[model samples]
Target: MSGVQDQLEIKFRLTDGSDIGPKSFPAATSVATLKESILAQWPKEKVSGPMTVKDVKLISAGKILENNRTVGECRSPLCDIPGGVTTMHVVVQPPALEKGIGIVQDIAQTI
Candidate 1:
């Protein structure tokens, strides 16, 4: 309540043209936290949803925001219009295959 002015309205636009929120968050909130929120609210009907925060990527102003950066830090002048909600694109990247396992097996066969 004290820092209501510091609260930013954010909406996550998913790849399927669905949205997760237009919710208010403190400026100090981290990108990782936003991902966790998205994971929690992911639509049950949607297929291939992100399984963890690591699978989610937040993009704003054509830049992929780092997990360590706070929401305030990721905001750009063009995207942070006063009293306007910021829309960030959400991308879910599936975990990579385990290539190391195959490589180790090959080395063992060679030995």
Candidate 2:
């Protein structure tokens, strides 16, 4: 007899200290899908500038996660120890230098 693997309810803790969600998905869900969800739920008010997928990264248990991997594939030690639910970390990278650092220039003008 075969039984289904349980879906995971994953919450995200942002590097900016914002909490995103406890979104649920199947264990086989792709990392690309997860990132899309995060991008959707990200707080627009919290943004200092424009955001992009390339600026977002997900980490678990101190390890950077790859977009092609599944959540289950990247499950961290914390996920197993925390009574079953998984919490991932989100890091927002600085936008590419091509973006011109307009926010920084604006801040300098204010100072």
Candidate 3:
């Protein structure tokens, strides 16, 4: 019974309004760990899903969860509801293109 209280039921709501899970994670799990899990379970058929954990962001209770924060620490009062599954929005923003890749440099002495 005590162990059950230590688990958090979370569902990842994707941009398309589809959900990935209502999975249970240990309260001690870090937000970064959740991102990894989300990346792994992301639908392969989705053309533009996150390619890495670094590209995944988890938003709960209208706030973005910090990577270093534990699930327990990120929980809001809404999460205190008994036996309710918390829904976190998943946003996949891929890393920007490498810097200086598109710039054309011309080194010519004015003549």
Alpha-carbon TM-score of each model against the true structure: 0.84, 0.72, 0.83
- In candidate 3, the residue pairs with backbone N, CA or C atoms under 3 Å apart (3 or more residues apart, or in different chains) clash, namely none
lDDT, candidate 2, at 17: 71
What candidate 3 gets wrong by more than 4 Å, as runs, is 97-111
Q: Which stretches of candidate 2 lie over 4 Å from their true place?
A: 1-4, 81-83, 97-111
Ranking by TM-score: 1, 3, 2
* lDDT assessment of candidate 3: 0.86
TM-score of 3: 0.83
lDDT of 2 by residue, 1-111 (tens): 112344777888987676877776777788778878888887878855326667777788878888888877877654564335577888777766646788779889999
Clash pairs, model 2 backbone: none
* Two-way TM-score contest, 1 vs 2, winner: 1
lDDT of 1 at 48: 86
Better of 1 and 3 by lDDT: 1
Order of quality (lDDT): 1, 3, 2
Clashing pairs in 1: none
